[model samples]
Each structure stands twice: as structure tokens, then as C-alpha cells.
Target: MYVLIVGAGQVGKMIASNLEDSHDVAVVDRDSETAEDLTYEYDVLSVEGDGTELETLREAGLEKADLVVASTDSDETNIVVCGTAKTASDAFTIARVRRRTLLNTWEGTQGAFGVDFMVCTDLLVAQTIFRISGFPRAQDVETFAGGLVRMAEFEIGPQSPLVGERVEDVDEYDSMTFAGVFRGDEMIVARGDTVFCADDRIVVIGSPTSVKEFAMANVPETTSSAEDVVVVGGSEIGYQAAREFEAHGFEPRLIERDHDRARELAEALPKTFVMESDATDTEFLDREHIDEADIVIAALESDEKNLLVSLLARRVGVDRTVAIIENTEYTDLFETVGVDVAINPREETAEEIVRFTRTNQTEKIAMLEHDRAEVIEVELGPDSALTGRRIADSAADLPDCVVIGAISRRGDLVTPRGTTVLEAGDHVVLFVDAAVLDEVSTVL
Candidate 1:
């Protein structure tokens, strides 16, 4: 497929990087240096011009493009780019925005801005934070097969009970599969003899019940529920996160230094406690007993402030700390320095936008460990390579890095095993190394 990406920013560059390996990609940016940099960085056509202009779109070969993505930092510019692209071509248009209001408006009126699909960065980050908050020690979480199958990534803390247990011995959960493990920079495919270690990010996929049971077992001391949640900052992402918790029946507390913004948030969020105070103030933190909270989320606009808040929360005895990181490079550093999880809004937005580039056979996608691997849900067609073969036999013909995580047949969860046979119409979720993603897609 030929893809034309507008705005060559972080999200656009990521989307280009993910697709340039499989499709024909062209990027349009107003900055000559950025366009030149992208041209030399990846095997893509880089056009220097305004994306919303018709002449620029023509120069970028939009006439023959299969997809057009508008991913500028400005929400209005992205919307206009998509709308403008629609006037000249029939390519599938995707716009990335930071405002929930724009997404709601586009949803209420489908294709309102000539955008075939829209992704809200703040909203996606908020939802991701909310999902991670549900399971203790989970670095990332995603659901597949209509919530029947779940995939979770948990970091083994220094004191975790499964520190030295072998994968085979930890197979107590009948329906769960040990998909893979991320140890430092190495991606180890899980096996019977694979032993758990401290700080290892283990990815598991299975029935929801099994996943939940595994989470509870992994952290026996931490309660399964996140009751007392605290959000620092009044940014859109922070406010949306507090709203998400409130919608789920948790009256979270939000701290914003700006009195006007705090009042606005308090008015908008009925169940959330919005306090006007500096989150760094130790006296205020102690007076409110913030140390007793189950989780403290640092969503301030500044990366340094979020890091400071996360470290302070940890110092104050909060069970977990989730920080919003604006810089992609700071993700690993923040986690290494003590933040439980560091989420990049642009990364989340890029992942969501790239999901649309998958083949029609793919139903959903979840990128893990910063695109090192991917867990994808695919429906087997009548002509699929594995439709009539047992998984054990099919394994010989498939890539070594791929693992059949779970299967949903007739709305029932089916745990994958070597003896299990795959049939047409089965929704199979598989964990695959990103390096072989294209090859795996071709076969299944």
C-alpha cells in the first residue's frame, strides 16, 4: 500500500517507520530540514510543503496513495489536512488530535472532517493509564477477542514471589500462556525452562480470569483493586484520567496548582476531588495523606515535573507511580529511576494510528516493549495456512518467534496448545516478533 503522511513529527515519523518496511511511504512537512532528515532516515519520499495545500498533496503523489495520515502537533492542522486530502483523493484519511471534543464531534457525525478515522492522543493515554491502574505491577495491558482474551505485561519487582520460578512450574493457571519475556535489551521467547528474574517484563496472554488470577498471584501483598487514586496536574490528559476513574466509580483526587483550572476541573468532574495546590508541597501531601493512595499518576505538562512528582510519590510510600512522559527518550530512564510506568502520548497515538494499516484479516493489535514485538488478533480465513493443521504441525512452517497466544471459537475462549487444531473463522491472537510481522501477516 502507498501511504502519504503529513507533518513528519514524532507520531508521523513513528508511523512511517512502522510502515516503510512493508508499504510505499511518503512524508510531507513544512520544514526543509525535517523533510530532508526523514528522507535520509528512512526509505520514503519526503516532500517539503504545506500538507493542506492541494499543490503540495499533488507533489506528494496523493493521487495514487492508498492512505493519508494527518499527524501534525496542532489538532486543527491535522483535521484540515485530512479534510483537504479528501477533496482530491479517495485515500483512507486518518487524523491525530489531542482534544477529546474533536473526537466526540467526529464520532457523533461520522466523517465530519473528511477523516475516515480519528485518534485522540490525550484520551488514548487516559484510557491506557486507567487500564494499567486496574492490575498491580502491570506495565501495559490490552484485551482481545471481545474481552474474552487478555494480554498483560508485568514487571517482576525485586520482592515478587515468582522471582526464581520456572515457566513450567508457574503454569498453574490452566488457561494462561507465558508468551514472552523482556530481559533488558534481549527478547526471550518463553519456554518451559525459562526462569523468572527481577525486573523482567513478562508478557502473558490468556482468558481474563486466568490473567487476573496471575496478576493477584504475582503481587500477593498489593490488593487487586486500586481504590485510592491520585492524579497530579490539570492538563487535558490528567483531567481525562481523573474522569475515567470517576466514571468507573472511583472518586479520585486531582491536584492542580492553578486555582482557575482547579475550579474548572472541579466543576466538570463531579466525582473527582479537585484541589488547588502545588503537588510538590510536602505539607499538603502529608495533610491529605497522599502517601496512603494506591496509585499516584503524574500527568503534568513538563517531563521533569512529572518525574519529580513520581519520585516524590514513591518516596511518600505510594504503592505505584505512573508518569506521563512527553519525550520518548525519557520512557526507559523514568522507569529505571523509579517511576513504575512512563507513558508517552505520541507513542500511544502512533500505535493506534498504525493499527489501521493492518490487513483486513487482523482485528486488533497491541505493540509491546516499544515496538519490539506485537500481539495481534487475526481471524482465520478459509484459505489460511493453518486452517486445517494442528498447531504442532503448523509450527514447523512458521517463524520461530511467533506464539499462538489464545483463540476464540464461537465466542468461547480456547487455550492454545501444541495439539490444538486451528479452523476457519477462529479468532486467533498471536504474539510475534516485530521483525517477522510482515512475514507472519502473509501466512495468516
Candidate 2:
């Protein structure tokens, strides 16, 4: 496969890095230095030009490009780039846009602007954060097979009930599977004797109810519902979170520093209490009783401001805080400084793009333990390798690091035992070591 990506920003560069290892990749950016840096870092071909221009795209060899991703910061430029690429080549085109209006218009019109797919960064990040809100300690959560199967990852806290319990003694839920365990640099395929330690990141796949049961059994307090929630900033992310919370029957209180934006948000979200106050000021938070909330969400546009507000919320005695981080490099630092989780929009966007690049029957992909392992959901067809076969026999012949976590059939969730048989039309969710992803793909 050959891929040509426009914009050498973090999202574009990350996509190029992921694709260059297995497919031919070329990146075009107006910034010569950024394009050059990607060329050296990822060993991908780089073209310095305006991708929105027909002549510039032609110079980048778009006619032979199998896929073109328009990821420039400007939505207009990205739309034009995709339209031009479609006009010049038969390649699939994807546009990365932050504006919700463009997404709605393009999606409803069915490639009216020539984009095969559109990704809204803010909306995706907002939706992701909403799904994992108060989901115990899950740093990341993804659902597959019509919400019947769930994949969750989290850092083991010192107070967790299962801290010293072996996997066998953890009282396995009927529908849950312990997928993978990570301790620093090692990735361990979770087994009966495997012991969970403090700070060890664990990934699990199971039915939603079973996953919730596991969380309640292990990390009870953080998973508590019906708590006060306070969200900072009136940006797109903040407003989206407010709306999502409202849909979930939560009348969250939102604090916006800008008076005009606060009024607009108040009108937009009828259930949420929109307040006009300086989120950075400790006095404002104390006066408003913001620290009394169970969770504080920092969605300010600036990474620095988000970090500051999260710190202030913690200082004021908020137990858990989730912050939107624009800078990917500040993730670990933010966590170390007491922020519960830092959401990286660019990284999330890149993961979505890379997942869409897969050529097999894979429907969804979730990166676990910082990409050391991955959980992929694939549909079994009549001709596929595992269809109508017992898992015990098939799993024995499969790669060592691969494990079948669950199977979804006609909306029913099944935690596959050795005797379980995989049938056609079943969606099989498998956890595989990142090193063996390609090998597993070939067999599937």
C-alpha cells in the first residue's frame, strides 16, 4: 500500500510513522523543517508544498498514491486537498477537520466535497473522554460488537482490592477475560497464576456488565455514580462533554472564564449550570464550591492552562481530575503532577486513522499499554480460518502471544472457553502482542 499524507503536524507525522513500517508513505507539508524532520525520523518520503494546490499535489505524485490523508490544520485547506486528490487519483481520501459544521455537511452530502471519510478531532476526543468518565480507573476504554464487548485498561492503584490477588483467585466474572498485563517494558499474557502488582497496567475484555462488576469489586470509590461534576472552559471539548453528561442524566456544573461563551453554552446545554468565572483563580473556585465536585474536567485550549486548573482542582481537594492535553509530550508529567488522566486529542486522532488503514476484516482496534499490545475485533466469514472451529484446537496452533478474549454473536456476548466454537458472522475480539499483529492478521 502507498499512502500520501498532507500536513506534517503531530497527527500526520504519527500516521506516517505507523504506516511507513509496513507500507510506502509520503508526507507533504508547507513547513520545510517539519517535513524534513519526518523524512529522517520515519524514513518516509517528504514533499514540501501546499497540498491544497493541484500542481503541488501533482508534484508529490498523487496519481499513484493509494490513499491520501488531508490533515492540515485548516479545514478548508484539508477539504480542498481531498477534493483535488480525488479529482487527480482513484485513491481513498480522508480529511481531518476540527469543525463540527463541516463534518455534518460533508457526511450528510456523501462525499460532496470528495472526502471518503472525515474525522473531527474535538468531537472524537470528547466522545472518548465521555465513554471513560468514572469508568473506574480505566485510562482508555473501547467498546466493540454493539457494546457487548468492552476493552478497558488501567494503572493498578495501591488501594485496589485485587492488588495482591492472583488472576485465578480474582473470582473471574463469567463474561470477562484478563487480556494482557504490563509491568514496565514487559508484556505478559495474563494467566491463572499471574499476579497483579501496584502500578502494573492491566487490560481486560468482557461484557459491559461484567467489566463494571470487576471495577466495582476492585476500585469501588472511583467508579461511584451520582457525584457532582465540574467542567472548566467553554471550548468545543468542554461543551461536548457537558452535552454528553446531560444525555447521561447528569446536570454537571460548568465554569467558563469568558462571559460571552458562558452565556452561549448555557443556552446550548439546558441541563448544565454554566457559570462565568475565572477558572484559574483559586478564589473563584472556592467561592463557587467547585472543589466539592467529584470530578473536575479541564478542557481549556492551552495545555498550560488545563494543567494549572487541574492542579488547582486537586489542591482544593477534588479527588479525581481529567484534563484535555493538546501537547502529547506533557502526558506523563501531567499524571505525575496529580492529574488523573491527560487526554491527548492528536494521539487519539492518529490511532483512529491508523486503525482505518487496516486492509483486513478488522472492524475496530484499541492500543493497550502504550501500543505494546493491541485488541482487534474482526468478523468471521464462512471462508475465514477460524469459522466453525473449536477454539481449543485453533488457539493451540495460533501465535504464542495471541488470545481470544470474547465472541459476539447476534448481539450476545460470549467469553470463549477452550470448547467454544467460532461460527460465521461472529465478531471475535482478540488480544495480540504488537510484535505479532502481522502474523495474527495473516492467519485470520
Candidate 3:
């Protein structure tokens, strides 16, 4: 497959990096230095030109491109780049926009802007925050198989009950599967004898109820569903997050500094408590009793501000803190410095867009731990190697890094086990090491 990505920003670079190893990839950016850097950083062709121009698109070989991703920072530029690419090539075009309004408009009018698919960055971040809010102690959360199956990564605190328990001993949930564990930089495939350790980010996939049960078992107090939510920002992402919580039956509090924006949010979100004050104001936070909240979400536009807000919330005695991080490099730093979870909009946007680039029958995808691993749902075809064999038999032929997490057969959740027989048309969700993703994906 030949993929052309227009933009050398973080999102574009991430997509390019993921695809260059498996497909022919090219990148177009207006900055000469960015284009030159991309050329040296990855095994991709780089064109230094304005992606919105047809001549520039031609220079990037858009004529023979199988897929085109417009990921420039400007939503207008991305839309125009996709529209221009569509005018000349038969490639499927994806536009990355930060505005949810554009996504709504594109959804109502399918392919309105010549974009085969549109990824809204702020909305994705908001949704991620909402998902993480449900599992209070989880570092990451994702739902697959039409929301029946869920994947959660939880970091084992030093005080966690499961700290010294083996996977077999803690395998109490009927539907949950211990997929993998990330200890420092190493990826350990979960086994019955694998012992839980402090600071280990363990990935679990199973029915939502079972996943919740597992969470509650380990950290009952911290893993319960978050009810008292506080959002510290009136940015689009923050507003959407507050609205998401409200839609789900939670009356979340939102703190906005601007009076007009706070009033606008109050009117837009009837159930949300929109307050006009600085989120970093210690006195205001104390007055509002923000320390009593179940979770505090920092969605400020600036990464530095979000970090400050998250740290402040923690200092004020908030149970958990979820912050929106614009820079991918700051994710680990934010979490290391005490933020419970750092949501990166660009990474989420890139992950969403990369799923469409798959050549096989992949239904959904969730990248974990900064692309070190992935949990993907794929439908088995008649020709698939694992279609007619038991999972135990099929897994033996695959790499040890791959773990079949869950399966969905005709709208029913199927907990994967060694004896479980795989069948055609079944949607199988598997946790795979990034190193073997292409290999495992090809066979499945």
C-alpha cells in the first residue's frame, strides 16, 4: 500500500512512522526543515510544499497514492488538502480536525468535504477522558466489540491488594483475560504464573462488567465509578468532557476563568455547574470544595496549564486527576509528576486514522503505552489460519507476544480460553506486541 500523509506534525509523523515499516509512505510539509527531518527520521519520501495546492499534491505522488491523510494543524487546510487529493486521486482521504462541529457537519453529509473519514481531536480526547473517568484507577480504557468487550490498563499501586498475587490467584473474574503487562520498558505476556508487581501496568480485556469487577477487587475505593467530576477548563475539550459526563447522568462541575465562556457553557450544558474562576486559584478551589471531588479533569489548551491544574487538584486532595496533554512527549512526565492519567489528543487522533489504513478486516484498534503494544479487533474470514482451529492450537503457531483477549460471535461476548474454538465471522480481539503487530495482523 502507498500512503501519503500531508503534514509533518506529531500526528502525521506518528502515522508515517507506523506505516513506513509495512507500506510505502510519503509525507508533505510546507516547512523545508520538517520535510528534511521526516526524510531522515523514517523510511519515507518527503515533499516540501503546501499540501493544499494541487501542484504540491502531484509532487508528493498523490496520483498513485492508495490513501491520503490530511493532518495539518489547520482544520481548513486539512479539509482543502483532502478535497484537492480527492479531485486528482482515487485514494481514500482522511481529515484530522480539532473541531467537533466540522465532524458533525461531515457526518450529517457523508463525504461532504471529500474526506472518506474525519477524526476530531478534541472530541476524541474528551471521549477518552470520559472513558477513563469510569474506571477511576485505570491508566487507559477502551471499549471494543460494540461496547461489549472492554480493554483497560491499570497501574498497580504499591498499596494495591493484588501487589503480590499471581495472575492465577487473581483470576477470579470469569470473563476477564490478563492480556499483558508493561514493566518499565519491557513487555511481558501475561501467564498464569505471572505475579502482579507494583508499578506494573497490566492490560486486561473482557466483558465490561467483568473488567469493572476486577478493578473493584484490587482498588475498591479508588476503582468505583467516579461521580463527583470537576473539569478545569472551558476549552472545547473540557466543555465536551463536561457534556459527556452530563449526558451519562453525572452533574459535573466545570471551572472556567472567562465569565462569558462560563456563561456560555452554563447555557450549553444545563446540567453542568459552570463556575467563573481560575482553576489554579487555591482559594476558589477550596471554597468550591474541589478537594472532595471524585475526579478532577484538566483540559486546558496549554500543556503547562493542564499540568499545573492537575498538580493543584492533587494537592487539594482530589481522588484522581485526568489531564489533556497536547504534547506527546509530556505524557510520561505528566503521569510521573503525579497526574493519574494523561490524555494525548494527537496520539488518539493518529490511532483512529491509522485503523483505516489496514488492508485486512480489522474492526477496531486501541494503541497502548505509546504504541509499544496494541489491542485490535478483527473479524475472521474463511481463509484465516485460526478460523477452524482451537485458540490453543492456533496460538502455538503464532508468536508468544500475541494473546487472544476476547471474541464476539453473532453479538455475544465470548471469553477466550485455550480450549475455545475459533470460527469464521467471529470478531477476535487480541493484544499484540507492536513488534509483531504486522506479522500477527497478516495471519489473523
Which candidate has the top score in lDDT? 1
Minimal lDDT window, size 10, model 3 = 216-225
lDDT of 2 by residue, 154-227 (tens): 77788888788899898569999988888878999988888999878888899888887887778646655426
Off by over 4 Å in 1: none
Q: What is the C-alpha lDDT of each candidate?
A: 0.93, 0.85, 0.91
Score candidate 2 by TM-score against the native. 0.96
lDDT of 3 by residue, 1-444 (tens): 899999999999999989989989989999999999987899999999999999999988898999999998999999999999989999999999988899999999978999999999888888898898888799999999999999999988888898988999888888999999999999999999999889899999999888888888786366468989999999999998988888889999999999898899999999998899998889999999999999999888899999999999999899999988887889889999999898888899999999998856999899999899999999999999999999888977789999999999999999888889999999999999989987887787
Q: How many backbone clashes does candidate 1 have?
A: 0
lDDT for residue 26 in candidate 2, whole number 0-100: 87
Better of 1 and 3 by lDDT: 1
In candidate 3, how many Å is residue 253 off? 0.7
How far does residue 52 in candidate 3 sit from its true spot (Å)? 0.8
